[model samples]
Target: MDLGTSLINVALLAMLFVVAVAIIRMRSLFAIVMLAGAYSLLSATWFVVLDAVDVAFTEAAVGAGISTALMLGAMLLTSRTAKSERAILGVVPFLVCVLTGAVLIYATIDLPALGDAASAANSHVGAQYLERVQADTGVPNVVTAVLASYRGFDTLGETCVIFAAGVAVVLLLGFGERSLSARSDKGRSRKESK
Candidate 1:
């Protein structure tokens, strides 16, 4: 990538990191939810920078839009502030996370360098796909052709999964609100009778 792209990526990543830290340190559930949405939006921006428009769209819709709305709905049925509790730093979980990250980084060491023309993926299926996509699907955009024609079922499945998650969130929040209101109504009836 060019210097400008690299700089943009660095700035985005830095902002993402800052937002993540703020989310972790935040005590208010509302603020945390907002920050999480911001994090998702930043992630979508980074995906766009990498030229993954479809993935960016999915992230923005699912992460920033639907997830934030669901969280805000759930928050309506719960406390806005987190309960105060003793902070206990767990060493084992931290170590496990570090070890997992280290293993993932180590695994990537065997992967080919970015945009390496000689990489197996670049030399084989990718090259064939690019060469044949126009002929096979009559789509001018390779990414569109691959996603729409080659991986249509996968895309549809992903869409269904996102839809189901949104429905589930709405149902849960609705049920929670109904239960809370029912209890409040019962309490009011009891108080009036007394």
Candidate 2:
């Protein structure tokens, strides 16, 4: 990658880290959901820097857009603020997360460098796909050809999954006579009255 693109990627990663920290610390459901969306957008930007525009588009649309909307809808059924928890109770989960992160980082050590021409992927299937895509699919753009022709069923499956998720979220949040939030509020009021 060029220096400028690398710098942009680093900046986006930093932003994503900051957003993640904010999401972890915040008690407000709305704020946390917004930060999660922002984190997804930063991730999409980094993917773009890596020349994975298709993945970036998917991240932006699904992660930032649809997922955020669904989460906000789900959040409406719960209290706006999270219940406070004892700090000691968080220690085990925090340590588990740290260990998982360390393991994941260590696992990347043996992976080939990005864009390495000698890498197994770049030297084999990727090259073969590039060579045959145009003739097989009659598509000039390899990415389009791969998605629309080579992996058509996979793409359709993904689209169906996203659509199903949206429908499920809508049904969960909006199908009842009263919103889940309203029912919860009414129950709280009845308890208070008693």
Candidate 3:
């Protein structure tokens, strides 16, 4: 189990890295959104292999599902293809990404390997969610207890973010329709003048 899950986790982590590169390289906004979703799914798999089920579920929901859906919908409402240029994002994003990856790797170096007995994550507040949830928050199942009681505020914040995204998408949908029509009209006039 250890070797199998470790391999899966590492493979998914590599996929996440590749998808990040692909997202940057993709020319279509729709393709970029889809690649972002693939990255999220890979990250969720990594979280699951690291035994962080709660975080994985949240990431899968917001990142892979809702966020991706909204982004793709917005892309469809906007441009069919993204504008391409030969320019890169300067050097800042690459530098920041390298620094962040280095920091994460350095931080993990001292941590227990996956499935290790001394894995502090497995012995943390998650156990309380499983064992003493009825006493702690009056819920029997740990998932329900955590979502309903412990992290209710965080979920509410996520809901607010989704609501804001919906509003923004609505505005973009209206504006994009108008822009598309105007572009079509201009194209027709240009051809007629020719």
Give every collision pair in model 1.
Answer: none
Candidate 2 residue pairs that clash? none
Question: Model 3 over residues 90-133: C-alpha lDDT tens digits?
Answer: 69899999999999999999988656755787678766566777
TM-score of each: 0.76, 0.78, 0.64
Query: Cα lDDT of model 3 overall?
Result: 0.82
Residue pair clashes in candidate 3:
none
Best by TM-score: 2
Q: TM-score of model 3 relative to the true fold?
A: 0.64
Q: Score each candidate by Cα lDDT.
A: 0.91, 0.88, 0.82
Clashes of each: 0, 0, 0
1-194 per-residue lDDT for model 1 (tens digits): 78999999999999999999998778899999999999999999999998889889989998999999989987987889987778797999999999999999999999997678899988998999998997898988898888778999998998899799779977865445777889999999999999
Question: Where does candidate 2 have its weakest 10-residue lDDT segment?
Answer: 170-179
The true-versus-predicted C-alpha distance at residue 104 of model 1, in Å, is 2.6
Name the candidate that leads on lDDT. Answer: 1
TM-score (C-alpha) between model 2 and the true structure: 0.78
Candidate 1 ranges beyond 4 A from true positions: 162-194
